[model samples]
Target: MRILLWHVHAAWTTAFLQGPHTYLVPVTAERGPYGRGRAQTYDWPASCVELTPAELAGADVDLVVLQRPEEWALAARWLRRIPGRDVPVVYVEHNTPRRDVPDSPHPMADRDDVTLVHVSHFNDLFWNAGGTRTVVIEHGICPPAAEYTGELDRVGVAINEPLRRWRVTGTDLLPRFCEVAGLDVFGIGAGRLRGLLPPGTGLYDDPPQHELHRQLARRRVYLHPMRWTSLGLSLLEAMMIGIPVVALATTEAVEAVPPQSGVLSTRVDTLVEAVRWLIKDPETATEVGSRGQAAVRARYGLDRFLAAWERLFKEVAPCMSTPSTAR
Candidate 1:
């Protein structure tokens, strides 16, 4: 099947290329994380083709897959003009939107032709959109074999966007924890901290995935302070490397990590205590890390994720071929 995947977010392209099928991606004018538009191109597989929006207009595409809700208007317009206009469209929600709006203003929430896929089961339960075909597909990680040999004094934190007054990410809590625990934090969005964080905290505007993984493996513990959202990819990468994680017990995190892997608590005192405990007891920390690794391998491996996607594709394909009764 000829599939057209629309990924506004750069990371989704990495995962989309894993399937053994012909995939088409839209080339964007905006530069990505690594560098200038020339420096950071997507690492697409041999089976995939990158096309311009104008080229896509004339191509014979089967399915238009969207990774975020904001892209619904664009997909809707594309669906209306494509030859097989009734082709199946899928929307994958990577994070829960700000649902606290007076009334949920999500346009595709009630869309009949669009199927919603969530990255976490917890997200599916929390997001209330009636009459929508919703499925939970958890994020997967590449398993690690060798144990990490990095120093334990460093703690790694990653955030794509800084927390504004409207959105909260637990970044506010990091400085306080770092000060109390005497740990060095390497992170993105350091500007968000401005005068809050002490000296010597490593900050980067952007880093490649391979480099990010390398840095994360060196850290003794991975600290996630995200107050509202589904499980972040950074947390999974740390767990896969057998690095213990200390995060807030909110959103999908409570369901993603086990008690043995690390401590999950909302209390500041509890988090502070957990950080200290993990730092002092290397053996216990390693044990927790091992459990996290095992959990990720068993539950969120790539093979399992691809198999689920294959099954979903098969189920939706026939629906696309059938004519709707509305017409």
Candidate 2:
């Protein structure tokens, strides 16, 4: 089936491209200021089209998949202009708590044509979108089998930015936690948040995805101190590579990481203690990492995710007119 996916988020793009179908992507003229530049774009084996807004308006598109709520207006316009009013529009929610926008209560939330797809089950439960048709589609990972057996001394933390003061990502909590744990933390963000890094922790400017994965594999433990939001793709990727995660017991992390895999706590002292415990006991950490890797492969692999999407698309797509129905 022909699908038009307009997802600015690179990870979403990567996931959709893995499916077997025609895909259309909208390219932006501007580069992303935060994070590494967009993931390299390549023509997929399936019929693929890359278009600008003007080109998209004139093209014969089928389904339009939007990744952000802010893009609803543009998507709505496209839907209206499409030849048949039966075209389905899907919204992929990548964030949690849904507080990025003021709680204005969008009218589109009540529309049957618009379907909301959350990246995590936690997000689907927490977000306030007023009775919209919602589905949970967790992020998928393509993990390498070759494990990193090198010396693993460092602890890694990956984020697009050093947590902003007002944002709920728990940036301020990291420095204090690092002070007590003495774990080396590295992250990606604008240099503007320089002083935000804990005293002796190392910081690497945003690196490419493969490079970042390599760097993460070198670290013995991955620390996810996010106070709010759904489980991040990076956290899942680390687990896929057999790295135990020390994260807060919030959102999807509670569901993603089992008790044997890692420690989950809400208190700062508990978080610090978990990091130290993992650091002191390498064997235990390794075992937990192994369990995590197995779990990720069984549940969050690309094949399972693609299958789920296929079922979803088949169910959601409008019924084509058969010869009998047309008559």
- Scored by lDDT, the top model is 1
lDDT of 1 at 252: 85
Each model's TM-score? 0.85, 0.84
lDDT of 1 by residue, 1-327 (tens): 677776455555566557776777666556332112222433546767766656766777777777655455554554346322456777777776576633443445776777788889866776766788889778866554335644656677777765452136777687767765544443445456555567766665556666667777777777888888777777777888888988899888887788787789989778877877787777788888889888877888877887777778777776434322210
Question: Per-residue lDDT of 1-327 in model 2, one digit per residue for the tens?
Answer: 667766466655666677766677665577332112235532234455666666667766656676655555665564346322457677777776544444534334665667788888877666666877888888776665436441466677776666553246676776756654444444456354567565666677676666667777877788887877677777788888888888888888888887687778888788777777777778888888889888888878887787777767766774522122100
Error of 1 at 155 (Å): 1.0
Runs of candidate 2 exceeding 4 Å displacement = 31-49, 76-86, 98-108, 144-146, 165-167, 180-190, 318-327
Model 2: residue 107 alpha-carbon error in angstroms: 7.0
Error of 2 at 21 (Å): 1.8
Clashes by residue pair, model 2: none
What 10-residue stretch in candidate 1 is worst by lDDT?
31-40
Residue 113's lDDT in candidate 2: 67
Clashes of 2: 0
